[model samples]
Target: MIGGASAYDGTNCKAPGNCWEPKPGYPDKVAGSKYDPKHDPKEINKQSESIKAMEARNAQRVANFKKTGTFVYDVSKIPAAN
Candidate 1:
Protein backbone atom coordinates (compact mmCIF):
# COMPACT_ATOMS: atom_id res chain seq x y z
CA MET A 1 0.00 0.00 0.00
CA ILE A 2 1.36 3.46 -0.95
CA GLY A 3 -0.70 5.70 1.30
CA GLY A 4 -1.84 3.31 4.05
CA ALA A 5 -2.98 -0.28 4.73
CA SER A 6 -6.38 0.49 3.11
CA ALA A 7 -5.04 2.85 0.40
CA TYR A 8 -4.31 0.27 -2.33
CA ASP A 9 -5.83 -3.11 -1.77
CA GLY A 10 -5.13 -5.25 -4.85
CA THR A 11 -8.80 -6.29 -5.12
CA ASN A 12 -10.07 -2.67 -4.98
CA CYS A 13 -7.50 -0.10 -6.04
CA LYS A 14 -4.24 -0.21 -8.00
CA ALA A 15 -2.32 2.30 -5.91
CA PRO A 16 -3.14 5.31 -3.72
CA GLY A 17 -6.36 7.25 -4.61
CA ASN A 18 -7.12 4.88 -7.54
CA CYS A 19 -10.18 2.65 -7.41
CA TRP A 20 -11.25 0.17 -10.12
CA GLU A 21 -14.38 -1.38 -8.63
CA PRO A 22 -17.90 0.03 -8.29
CA LYS A 23 -19.34 0.81 -4.89
CA PRO A 24 -20.72 -2.09 -2.89
CA GLY A 25 -24.27 -3.26 -3.91
CA TYR A 26 -24.22 -0.98 -6.97
CA PRO A 27 -26.16 -2.13 -10.09
CA ASP A 28 -24.12 -4.35 -12.43
CA LYS A 29 -25.74 -2.92 -15.60
CA VAL A 30 -24.96 0.48 -17.10
CA ALA A 31 -27.08 3.51 -16.05
CA GLY A 32 -30.17 4.31 -18.22
CA SER A 33 -29.66 1.10 -20.26
CA LYS A 34 -33.26 0.11 -19.52
CA TYR A 35 -36.44 2.31 -19.49
CA ASP A 36 -34.74 5.13 -21.46
CA PRO A 37 -37.16 7.70 -22.91
CA LYS A 38 -35.56 7.46 -26.37
CA HIS A 39 -36.48 3.75 -26.46
CA ASP A 40 -40.05 4.14 -25.08
CA PRO A 41 -42.90 4.43 -27.60
CA LYS A 42 -45.21 6.44 -25.33
CA GLU A 43 -42.46 8.92 -24.49
CA ILE A 44 -41.61 9.33 -28.17
CA ASN A 45 -45.21 10.04 -29.07
CA LYS A 46 -45.56 12.60 -26.27
CA GLN A 47 -42.39 14.38 -27.33
CA SER A 48 -43.56 14.46 -30.95
CA GLU A 49 -46.90 16.01 -29.93
CA SER A 50 -45.07 18.68 -27.85
CA ILE A 51 -42.85 19.56 -30.81
CA LYS A 52 -45.86 19.82 -33.11
CA ALA A 53 -47.65 22.14 -30.69
CA MET A 54 -44.56 24.41 -30.50
CA GLU A 55 -44.30 24.54 -34.30
CA ALA A 56 -47.98 25.44 -34.60
CA ARG A 57 -47.60 28.26 -32.10
CA ASN A 58 -44.57 29.61 -33.97
CA ALA A 59 -46.44 29.47 -37.29
CA GLN A 60 -49.37 31.35 -35.79
CA ARG A 61 -47.05 34.04 -34.44
CA VAL A 62 -45.40 34.44 -37.86
CA ALA A 63 -48.77 34.72 -39.59
CA ASN A 64 -49.98 37.29 -37.05
CA PHE A 65 -46.86 39.41 -37.59
CA LYS A 66 -47.23 39.22 -41.36
CA LYS A 67 -50.89 40.28 -41.23
CA THR A 68 -50.49 43.12 -38.66
CA GLY A 69 -47.00 44.34 -39.69
CA THR A 70 -45.99 44.68 -36.00
CA PHE A 71 -44.59 42.37 -33.28
CA VAL A 72 -47.12 41.24 -30.70
CA TYR A 73 -46.00 40.44 -27.14
CA ASP A 74 -48.08 37.89 -25.29
CA VAL A 75 -47.62 38.55 -21.55
CA SER A 76 -48.97 35.74 -19.41
CA LYS A 77 -50.96 36.48 -16.30
CA ILE A 78 -48.86 35.95 -13.17
CA PRO A 79 -51.50 33.65 -11.61
CA ALA A 80 -53.00 32.01 -14.70
CA ALA A 81 -56.30 31.21 -12.93
CA ASN A 82 -57.03 34.92 -12.49
Candidate 2:
Protein backbone atom coordinates (compact mmCIF):
# COMPACT_ATOMS: atom_id res chain seq x y z
CA MET A 1 0.00 0.00 0.00
CA ILE A 2 1.17 3.59 -0.67
CA GLY A 3 0.04 5.02 2.66
CA GLY A 4 -3.38 6.09 4.02
CA ALA A 5 -5.49 7.59 1.20
CA SER A 6 -5.42 7.50 -2.58
CA ALA A 7 -5.01 11.33 -2.51
CA TYR A 8 -7.60 13.96 -1.61
CA ASP A 9 -10.50 12.45 0.31
CA GLY A 10 -13.13 15.17 0.23
CA THR A 11 -12.20 17.45 3.19
CA ASN A 12 -8.75 16.06 3.98
CA CYS A 13 -6.23 13.69 2.46
CA LYS A 14 -7.34 10.19 3.51
CA ALA A 15 -3.81 9.06 2.83
CA PRO A 16 -1.27 11.90 2.78
CA GLY A 17 1.96 11.06 0.96
CA ASN A 18 5.52 12.34 1.27
CA CYS A 19 6.08 15.88 0.02
CA TRP A 20 8.95 15.23 -2.38
CA GLU A 21 12.34 13.57 -2.55
CA PRO A 22 15.40 15.64 -1.75
CA LYS A 23 18.00 15.75 -4.50
CA PRO A 24 21.63 16.85 -4.46
CA GLY A 25 20.67 20.08 -6.23
CA TYR A 26 19.37 21.22 -9.60
CA PRO A 27 16.93 19.42 -11.90
CA ASP A 28 17.92 20.22 -15.49
CA LYS A 29 21.63 19.71 -14.77
CA VAL A 30 21.01 16.29 -13.28
CA ALA A 31 21.04 14.68 -16.77
CA GLY A 32 24.83 15.29 -17.06
CA SER A 33 24.42 18.78 -18.50
CA LYS A 34 25.58 21.65 -16.34
CA TYR A 35 26.71 25.16 -17.17
CA ASP A 36 30.41 25.39 -16.39
CA PRO A 37 31.75 28.84 -15.63
CA LYS A 38 35.15 27.66 -16.86
CA HIS A 39 33.79 27.71 -20.39
CA ASP A 40 32.56 31.30 -20.01
CA PRO A 41 34.61 32.96 -17.31
CA LYS A 42 34.48 36.16 -19.30
CA GLU A 43 30.69 36.20 -19.19
CA ILE A 44 30.80 35.59 -15.44
CA ASN A 45 33.31 38.39 -15.06
CA LYS A 46 31.12 40.67 -17.11
CA GLN A 47 28.12 39.86 -14.87
CA SER A 48 30.16 40.57 -11.73
CA GLU A 49 31.42 43.82 -13.23
CA SER A 50 27.84 44.80 -13.98
CA ILE A 51 26.82 44.17 -10.36
CA LYS A 52 29.74 46.22 -9.00
CA ALA A 53 28.95 49.07 -11.36
CA MET A 54 25.32 49.03 -10.27
CA GLU A 55 26.29 49.13 -6.59
CA ALA A 56 28.72 51.96 -7.21
CA ARG A 57 26.13 53.95 -9.10
CA ASN A 58 23.60 53.44 -6.28
CA ALA A 59 26.18 54.45 -3.66
CA GLN A 60 27.01 57.60 -5.63
CA ARG A 61 23.35 58.48 -5.86
CA VAL A 62 22.88 58.06 -2.10
CA ALA A 63 25.97 60.18 -1.38
CA ASN A 64 24.80 62.87 -3.76
CA PHE A 65 21.35 62.90 -2.13
CA LYS A 66 22.89 63.19 1.35
CA LYS A 67 25.02 66.10 0.24
CA THR A 68 22.60 67.93 -2.11
CA GLY A 69 19.25 66.66 -0.83
CA THR A 70 18.19 65.48 -4.33
CA PHE A 71 17.71 62.17 -6.09
CA VAL A 72 19.67 61.13 -9.17
CA TYR A 73 16.33 60.42 -10.84
CA ASP A 74 13.99 63.38 -10.59
CA VAL A 75 10.98 62.18 -8.62
CA SER A 76 9.57 65.70 -8.38
CA LYS A 77 8.14 65.37 -11.90
CA ILE A 78 6.26 62.21 -10.90
CA PRO A 79 3.09 62.58 -8.88
CA ALA A 80 3.47 61.99 -5.19
CA ALA A 81 2.58 58.44 -4.07
CA ASN A 82 -0.74 57.98 -2.34
Tens digit of per-residue lDDT, candidate 1, span 31-75: 565433355678769988999988876766666677667655452
| Candidate 2: residue 5 lDDT (0-100) | 62
Q: Give the alpha-carbon lDDT of every model.
A: 0.59, 0.59
Question: lDDT (0-100) at residue 48 of candidate 2?
Answer: 88
Judged by lDDT against the true structure, how good is candidate 2? 0.59
Give the per-residue lDDT digits (tens) of candidate 2, residues 1-82.
6877656433432344533432557453434456333456787699889999888767767766776786865433433335
Best by TM-score: 2
TM-score of each: 0.41, 0.43
